[model samples]
Target: MSKKVAVLVAGSWGTALASVLAANQLDVIMWTRGEDQATEINNKHTNQRFLPDAELSPRIQATTDMAKAVEGASAVLIVAPSSAMRSVAHQLKAHYKPEMLIIHATKGFETESLNRMSTVISEELECEEGRVVVLSGPSHAEEVVKRCPTTVVVASLDKASAEAAQGLFMNAYFRVYTNRDMIGVELAGAFKNIIALGAGMSDGLNFGDNAKAALLTRGLAEITRIGVEMGANPLTFSGLAGIGDLVVTATSQHSRNWRAGSLLGKGQKLDDVLNSMGMVVEGIRTTQAAHFISQKYGVQMPIADQLYHVLFQERQPRDAVEALMGRDPKTEMEVMTLETWEQWHS
Candidate 1:
């Protein structure tokens, strides 16, 4: 008998994951917030709004009924955007079975609460920390659905949950690695989008690959610095979720974050850029949330801070870049190896 898995949400990432599970011969049901999408999937095996070119598998079913989606499924994967995670989790809370494993594929911290996606899932579902897991990396929905080579990480405070998620998603083209650093994984996944925006901005300015590469390297440094201060293992930022994801997001034409940043660099207003994209660019909200958290936590998040200024305060992109370049010089490993502020070492 095939294992039953329910994937909530019907966006590109959600549909792609469902397709992967169905390809693995799992009994998968894709739950959508809209009846139209569910009907389209059930009748035509296509989600026209997203993934129009790709056909869904016969084994995969689509439905708008939340109860039917959750009931009797061995595991549930939440792929909604971070903005909707809390609501979706709350709606599923009453129906979540104790034995049913839950994992989140969404990345980004909540703007209002600044809570990571896993934290939102655990808190809303009243589940033990062990029951929740997070899967994130450089796996874009378009590439994953096409069976392109992709690697990602599954992380949880509980080892079993991480392993279970890895077992559920690993296949020939889609490889999953297990990690215990949930905070680091989540933060790395969420915060990298912000840097991707910076990278995109560099591209929009017609900066050479050298400039983009510099932004990426320094962006990883900033992400690692903040993640380490937040009790995350610094090594996690050096792995798939950190530099790996950054490379994909910062360089790919498929990245919505990069596209949005490109527009911003071209002098488009935030609202204008968002309206033009027609899809959720997770980086915009994430930039604000990261900025808030860095201020609250006193982490040195210069990239996120400048991105926030550009998005909200009407700061010019070139000026932001200038400000970043003009900052005080510091060693590359200062955040990682330095002991005290007063330690004088060049």
Candidate 2:
């Protein structure tokens, strides 16, 4: 008998991951709110709205019943939007089993609670946060559905949970790495979206490659500062969840946050920009959360702070750029104390 895996939601990312699980000979059942979507995936093996051109495997199924989706499944993958995570996790709590592995691929925080996805899931499911594995990196759902080569990281404080997630998701076309820095992995995944928005704004303003390169480089630096201050390993910022994810999201046309930022950069109103895109722009919400977080943590997040102004305070994007450029000059190596990074150079 094949192992059963339950995937929450039928969004593009969730559907793409379901395909990978099915390809691995696992029984995949996707739960979606729309009964029509469930029927289409169950009968036609297609999710035209999300993965327009991809065909799902027959081994993959869809259901509207959350309980049925979770029933007897060995692992449950939550790919809901960050805004929906808390409520979805609450619903899952009814069917959550102690032995079932919980993995979340959602990036972004709960703006209200300022909680990580795993933290929300653990609270809802009444499990330890360490048991929830986070899967993130440069992987895009569009490329993954086409069976293109993709790599991602699965991280957890629990070594067994991370390894189990790695084994479950790794494949010939999909490479998975295990990391112990769950805090770094999660924070890096969330914070990089802010920089991607910055990169997109740079492009939309017709700024050339030089400008974008600087923005991305400096953007990475600012996020690293804040992530480290938030208890993440500074080295994680240089790894897949940091630079890797930042590069892809900031550069790819497939990134919603990038597209959203481009619209804002072109002088579109925030509401208009958001209405133009049908998907959730995680970076916008993330910028808001990071704004408060940076203040609370006493970290200097120049890029995220400027983004907060542009996104919520109606400040012009170009003006935000100017503010960033006009900031007080400081040593480039101020990201950490000498003792923290001395080991690397020595």
Candidate 3:
């Protein structure tokens, strides 16, 4: 008999991961709220709206019933948008089993609570936080479904849980790495979205490579600063979850955050850009969350602060740029990592 896996909310990333599990010979059950989407996946094996031109594996199925989706599954993967994570996880609370491995691939903070996805899930489930694994890295759902070579990291405070998640997802085409730094992994994953939005806005403004490159560099610095302040390994930001994800999200056309930023840079209103995308742009909400997070941590997140203003305060994109440029000059060596780099260079 094949192993069973449950995936919450059949979005692009969720469906792509389900296909991976199906290919691994697991009975993958995807739970979605939409009757039409569930029917499309159950009968036609195609999720045209999300994964156009791709065929889902025969072993995969979709259902509107949450209980049916997770019932008797060995693992559950939550891929809902950050905004819906809490509610979905709460609905999942009734069906959640202690023995089942829990993993989440969503990459954003809860805007109102300023809590991470895992925290929200743990709060909803009333379980220890360490058991939940986070899946993140440079992997894009678009490329992953095509079986294009992809690598991702799974992290949990519990080593066994991380390894279990790794075993479930790793295969010939999809590679998985394990990390013990759950906080760092989660923080790096969420914070990078804010920078991607900035990078996209830069592109939309017709700023050439020079300007965009500078923005990415500074953006990484901002990410590192916050991650370090929040007890994340500074080196984690340099790893896949940090620099790798940041580079991909900030530059790639496949990145919804970068695309949303690009539209905003072209002087589109936040509402207009969001309406046009027709998909959840996690970075926008993250920027809003980060605005408060920065205050909580007492860390200065200049780029994220600018994005918060641009997305919510009606500040013009160019003006935000000017403000960033006009800020008081300070040596970048304020952080121990940069000072250490300076030491190495000297």
The weakest ten consecutive residues by lDDT in model 3 span 336-345
- Badly placed stretches (over 4 Å) of model 1 are 337-346
Model 1: lDDT equals: 0.88
Candidate 3, 6-31: lDDT as tens digits:
99989999999998998888999999
Q: Give the distance in Å from residue 237's predicted Cα in candidate 3 to where it truly belongs.
A: 0.6
- The alpha-carbon RMSD values of the candidates against the true structure, listed in the order shown, are 2.7, 1.5, 2.4
Q: What tens-digit string does per-residue lDDT give for candidate 1 at 1-346?
A: 2398999998999999988888788999888878888888888888878886888888788888889987789999999988999999998998898888899888798899998888888899888865689898988889898899889999998998889888888999999999999999999999999999999998988887999989998899888777877878878988999999999999998999999999888888889999988888999899999888888878888888989999999999999989999999988766655543222233
Candidate closer to the true structure by lDDT (higher is better), 2 or 3? 2
Q: Write the per-residue lDDT of candidate 2 for residues 1-346, one digit (tens) a residue.
A: 2299999989999999999998899999999999999999989999998889799999899999999999989999999999999999999999998999999999999999898899999999999999999999998899999999998999999999999989898999999999999998999999999999998898889988998899899889888877777778878889999999999999999998899988888988989988888778899999999999998988888999999999989899999999998988888887667655753355
- TM-scores of the models, in the given order? 0.96, 0.97, 0.96
Best by TM-score: 2
Shift of residue 98 alpha carbon in model 2, Å: 0.4
Error of 2 at 321 (Å): 0.7
lDDT of 2: 0.91
lDDT of each: 0.88, 0.91, 0.91
Best-to-worst ranking by lDDT: 2, 3, 1
